[model samples]
Target: MMEVIPKQFWEGVEQFNSGQFYACHDTLEALWMEASEPDKTFYQGVLQIAVGLYHFGNQNWRGAAILLGEGNNRLRRYPEVYSGIDVDELLDKSLTVLKTIQMAKPEELALLKLGEDENLPLPKIVRSA
Candidate 1:
């Protein structure tokens, strides 16, 4: 049986994909607050990743690392493709971004540019076909 995805979820995904991290957080959080079990966790993971990117954009290395790590850990609990999303891709890309952030020295953190980095482009949410 196919699970019905909410319109707001897609809205959140659009926000995330467009680099509107804060808006993505706001959109998904409403769903997360009322969701149950796996979905609750799933929404949280995506939301955290959005906020992590938000932190990264603001040059808050510590916040970016913490939330990205936490979000990746939560998302790992599900299958590679959960809720019609390409979870495997998301996990891989986000982990790459997280690792890149983690590997940066404090002095060099501010110089790092996301999406512009050839090896560490901003992660996007890809819906499974």
Candidate 2:
């Protein structure tokens, strides 16, 4: 049987992909609130992903790394939900991206100007549907 992805889950993903991290966090957190006890861990992991994205957008690399790492940790305990999505791969991608950003020299970081733009960079998810 196929596991149905909830509308709330897709909404949260869209918000995250759209660079509305805070909104993503709020949306997913609500879903987390209503999740059954056995499912709450997965929702909490999603909530952390939102927080990670929010921090990443804000140029808080360390914060993003920490939150993302924690989220991945939570995800490890429940790999069933991620069968088609490959959560481990996603976590690896995120960690690699953050590490690359963090390894840049201070001058490079200054030049990158992490938070100069008022607009958030929407991810590819926005264009899919």
Candidate 3:
């Protein structure tokens, strides 16, 4: 049986894709709040990733690193693909971005500009086939 993806999920994806990270978090949280255990954790992971990008874009490296690390940990237990998302790819990109931030000095990180010189690590919403 085919299940329909929630409108909230798609709206969250659109917000994330459009770089409205904070809005994306709010949209997804609306869905995640009512979810059960593992699925709730998964949605939280996605929300964390979005907020990580939001922080990164705004030059908040410490916050971004923390959220990305937390998000990655929550997401790690899931399969390569889950709940319509390409989990593996998302994890890879998140890790890549995290590593970049983790390696930079806090002062250097603050100096880093997003969408001006170096681009922020944004995830692609590749729905699983």
Candidate 4:
């Protein structure tokens, strides 16, 4: 386990919360590259979800669903709170977003707005208090 969460992780979270999914992926990728085992998978999960959101914003429903499902599954092995993150909450929220994307028709996907849609608020990474 990592003794300390790198500054980059929080930076990535900030970017993610701000709807800067592409930047979040870049920020977390650096940390993910150096992580091992649990941490490696953890960071990858977060990164994947960020990219998934980016795909959703771009109206790539398939990419959004795949990454969101994969990412949520990856994080499922971890505790509700791991590395100071609320993994359970993240999973729940992302799953809702994923389902919305999965259920949308190809033509309807273009009309869906992430965070702006009443049903599809963008998932945010909540830090454990």
Query: What does the lDDT come to for candidate 2?
Result: 0.62
Which residue window of length 10 is worst by lDDT in model 4? 113-122
lDDT of 1 at 101: 84
Count steric clashes of candidate 2.
Answer: 0
| TM-score, ranked from best to worst | 1, 4, 3, 2
Q: 67 in model 2: Cα distance from truth in Å?
A: 1.1
| Tens-place lDDT digits, model 2, residues 24-79 | 88887887888775467777876786687677667777787688778767767755
lDDT of 3: 0.83
Q: How high is the lDDT of residue 77 in model 4?
A: 93
Deviation of model 3 at 26, angstroms: 0.2
Query: By lDDT, who's the top model here?
Result: 1
Ranking of all candidate structures by their lDDT, best first: 1, 4, 3, 2
Per-residue alpha-carbon lDDT of model 3 for 4-38, expressed as tens digits? Answer: 56789889988987889999999999989988777
Better of 3 and 4 by TM-score: 4
The runs of at least 3 residues in candidate 4 whose Cα sits more than 4 Å from the true structure, single-residue gaps closed, are none
Instruction: Give the distance in Å from residue 67's predicted Cα in candidate 3 to where it truly belongs.
Output: 0.4
RMSD of 3: 2.4
Model 1 has an lDDT value of: 0.93
Reference-based TM-score of each model:
0.96, 0.68, 0.87, 0.95
TM-score of 4: 0.95
